[model samples]
Target: MANIDPIDARILARLQRRCDEPLEELGQHVGLSRNAVWRRVKALEERGVLVGRVAVVDPDAVGLGLMVFIQVRAGHHSADWLEKFRRAVRAMPEILGVYRMTGDLDYLLRARVADMADYDRLYQRLIARVDMGDVSASFVMEELKEGSALPL
Candidate 1:
């Protein structure tokens, strides 16, 4: 783990809320000069503490209002099967996240779509590409809290 001091933690907390905040403003919050903040930010990036900076888009604004959580049971557990599954999911842009899970479920996928018909299309494409023993999905009715920020 990276050595994060109190000041660094403060800076990270602020950045997680708004990364595009001006360096001068961020420095004021963390009790540092703009140059010092810039140096620390550079060090954070170099240490892989800060991997990326991106614009978070609203799914509803883009016409993708449905959020789906898909549970998958793999028919086979071979290395080749895993590779094929990875390739298939990676190729599909609608699949936002794919996780190899433990316990009864083999994998879980998160995707965004326009509606039930769009979700059906995504499901069809997924099943056609990979052999799944069982597939089930749950739609999110209401999102109480959704964010990518990590608690420091």
Candidate 2:
């Protein structure tokens, strides 16, 4: 990541809150010309600071009311096993986020489903494709906060 100055920080903060905000509005808020603001945005993108804009959708409204986190213990830690695991994850749309972490857990997956049955189906599919030592799932009853913003 590039060193972000005060101006870049302000632009990033504003963009995090609402990526779809008009360039003129962003310029007004950050005390820069629209062209200047656009330049900074483009530069940020080039530097890999600004990833990409995405629409925030309501999961519950779309029948994805259940949120489950699965902790996976890999049976084997090898390049072939890791490749198979990654491919299985990539093919599953229900699996939202996957993290390879330190500590006892080898992998963690955050997934969405309509209900337990849907989640079970996903679980069966995943395990059939990947050799996991153990898989433990936790269903979330409430989510306090969620966003893609960084504390820059």
Candidate 3:
């Protein structure tokens, strides 16, 4: 990790909440001049502490109301199989996150879709692209909290 002082932490916290906040306002909150905050932000980006900024959109509003966690068991563990799986997931925009996991599950996929039918289509497409031993999905009932902020 890069050297992050208290001010940098505060800046990161603020940015996590609102990436588009004016530099002057952010500086006021962090007790730094605008230029100082800018430099710090630039440095943080250079150090790769700060990645890309993006807008968080509402899934329901966008007609993607269902969030599903799909568990996958690999049919066979091989470089070719892994490469195919990676390419399949990366090409699917509905698949928001794919994690290579330990324990019983080989991989876990987080996806959003309009409904069960949409999910079925995604499943079909995925299975067509790659082979799997077993697949199961669980839909989210209520989201108590979901965020991208990291504790600084």
Q: Which candidate is the best by TM-score?
A: 3
Clashing pairs in 2: none
Off by over 4 Å in 1: none
Expressed as tens digits, the lDDT of each residue in 38-92 for candidate 2 is 9999999999988898888899999999999999999899999999999999999
Q: List the candidate 2 regions with Cα displacement exceeding 4 Å.
A: none
Best by lDDT: 3
| lDDT, model 2, position 78 | 98
Q: Give the alpha carbon lDDT tens digit for every residue of 1-152 in model 3.
A: 25889999999999999999999999999999999999999999999999889999999999999999999999899999999999999999999999999999999999999999999999999999999999999999899999999988
Worst 10 residues of 2 by lDDT: 1-10
In model 3, which residue pairs have backbone atoms overlapping below 3 Å?
Answer: none
The models' CA-based lDDT, in order, is 0.94, 0.95, 0.96
Sort every candidate by lDDT, greatest first: 3, 2, 1
Off by over 4 Å in 3: none
